[model samples]
Target chain A: MKKLWNIFKAGLVTDNPLLILMIGLCSALAVTSTVSNGIGMGLAMTFVLLFSEIFVSTFRKAIPSSVRMPIFLIIIGGFTTIVDLVLKAYFPELSKSMGVFIPLIVVNCIIMGRVEAFSYKQKLVDSIFDALGMGLGYTWVLVGMSAFREVLGNGTFLGVQVMPQSYQPILFFILPPGGFLIFGLFIAFNIWMKNRMALKAEAAAAKENA
Target chain B: MKGNARLGLILAVFAAIGCGTLAVVQGITAPAIAMQSEKALNESLKKLFPEAASFEDITETLKSTSKTVSFEKAYLVKSAAAPLGVAVKAVGSSYGGAAKLLVGVGLTRNIAGVTVLELADTAGLGQNAMNDAYYVNKAEKITFPGQFKGKYLTDAFEVKKDVVAITAATISSKALTEIVKTAADAAAAWLENQAAPVATPADQAAAAASGAPAQAGAAPTGGK
Candidate 1:
């Protein structure tokens, strides 16, 4: 139980998909336009990541050391394909909204990175916990970024008007450039906070030594 | 294998696998992808004339010939009524790059409506031109394009200021307007040759089947 807790905790904070691990940044940047699109993409990524990671872990011992990377890639590509086909057939609207980015999920560094890094080295149960944590981490960050952009950019929440008429909408919030601007600002702010925490950590370490 | 040799072999194998994976995906998805495109085209027509109980290719003759006609003819997607609208593929340069719209104007020949079947455009601002209320309204309100609705063969094409372009969406407006004019002309030419034979209810069922949406909701590239 303690081991499981450690795995889960590591994934959420220490190696969060967006913050610490910094994988899947492409979709993170592109689809973080609206909460709906973000959530749709997050769910899609979670399912894909969970299955691919598990499948890779299951086959890790079987794969010849000579061709493990190739095998791993084929697995990831196949899973991404199935996701694309299923979504196109069933959830056409979300598929459309996601656009090319859905297919681009095959190239998402996160899926491949986790499978190659942690899952390949870990046990099945540990990997599952890791996947769950990472998935939650991805979903939450995407939702947070999208919520920030949507409300401020559109003057609405989930498409409902939140602000009164007195406020004028900053049309730029919905533009493509605006996405880059907002994401950059958030990333910068996070980096600053991290540096501040690091300084505090160093100060505490110095005081302890003294 | 030595460490360096093994690394090289692994890299080569990985590259081959990536290429092979892409090939397999591109191969299998290619046909489905192409079919989805046809579905999108047909769906666009259906949206314009849902009541269009039926549709037939009156202008398909233009596609058969190898003769170089600078001006290719357009096609008709008729409703169960006397005839619903003119379905034509149009290409124009929008804010970003070349934009393709499948326009189906009313038989009245006025700018009825359109679907940006393909577009590589800036998202949201200039791209909003795909929306009905914006592009369709602006195209028609200007009177040059929409006025074509009810015009006979002799009506010359025109674009006026009243067809107010979206605030920052001029390129899109220009591109669509050009396509509409060419398509309207081609449609008019095709109509002149053909007899106004409206299809019976039996024909409507077949057309309805043909007009159902392509891949329902395919991935959105940059298009709407």
Candidate 2:
């Protein structure tokens, strides 16, 4: 259980797909304009990532290294289509808002990276934790960024007007440049948090030694 | 050689499984997807003509006017008592690409409403053309599409000069205005033909040929 928790924590903080690794930044920036879109995209990605990890881990030995890339792609593509179809059928509004980004999930490097680096070698239980941790980590960052952008950019939160009636929305925050601005701030904050944790850990070790 | 062959076999097996799974999922969702689109179309039509009990496709009966704008479909909105108006779906070039719109024109020769079906305009700028919350007149709560309601078919559909353009989205605004105008023109021409008490074969043939009936006196006077 402790080992599982550590693995999950690693995916969440020490090795976040966005803040630390920064593999799939394209969709992250594009869909973070609205809070609902951000949540929708994040959940869709998590669903795909979880299923892909499960399949890859379960069939790791059977999958030959020579043809693993193709196999991985097929699995990933199949899951992405499922997400696309389900969203279109049930959540048509979200499907419309997200547009091509859902299908584009097949190419998101976070899933590919995790499946290749962690799931390919790890046991099923460990892979599951990793997938959950990574998925939530990605979701939280996307939601945080979207919340900031939507409130300031559109003067709304989740399509509801939350800002005062007199507040003038800054359109720049909703554009591509604003995505970069918020993303940079998040990264800087993450780095600062990491440094503080490191300093505290070092001080605890010195106290133990004394 | 044996190892390579084995790898290929495994890859083929995985591909087959993947394809089979997708095929099954697609089969399950295909009907639902079709139903959703149909429902969405119905909802849009209902929103445009709230009193309309039924809509009959009249695309074949009407004639398209603008060379640039293509008329995709037209529907004759009717209540149980009488024909209400016409809804025309038209497509035109926009800043990003093709912009599709549905324009509802009443029998009284005024626009009932307009809704954007598909738009590929830039986010926050051109995209606001369809956003109901992005009010052109914040005090009156008049949206980009809201401004078109009750506008006469003969009114100049020019962006900025007449129609309110989306802020910093003149190209998108112009493209949308043009599409709406083309649709309104088509609806007006069709309505004029419907209102005519008697149509001679020659007049019908001429209307079909020129896309503007010779006896179009009742038609709203407009030139794109």
Candidates' DockQ values?
A: 0.14, 0.75
Model 2 Cα lDDT, one tens digit per residue, B53-145: 988777766656566788788888888777789998888888877787889999999999999888867767898987877888889999898
lDDT of 1 by residue, B1-224 (tens): 58768657755765576567657766766677667655766777777667766566543332211111112224566554567666766555556666666656565645555566555455445655553333345434532233334444344433345344555657666666666555555554444344344366666444434432321232322222
| Among all candidates shown, the one with the greatest lDDT | 2
Question: Which predicted model would earn the best DockQ?
Answer: 2
Quote each prediction's TM-score.
0.70, 0.85
Would you list the clashing residue pairs of candidate 2?
Answer: none
DockQ of 1: 0.14
Instruction: List per-model TM-scores for chain B.
Output: 0.58, 0.78
Model 2: residues >4 Å from true position, as ranges? A207-210, B1-5, B58-73, B81-83, B91-98, B120-123, B186-224
User: Which pairs of residues clash in candidate 1, taking residues 3 or more apart in a chain or in different chains?
Assistant: A99-B220, B39-B214, B108-B149, B108-B150, B109-B148, B109-B149, B110-B149, B111-B146, B142-B163
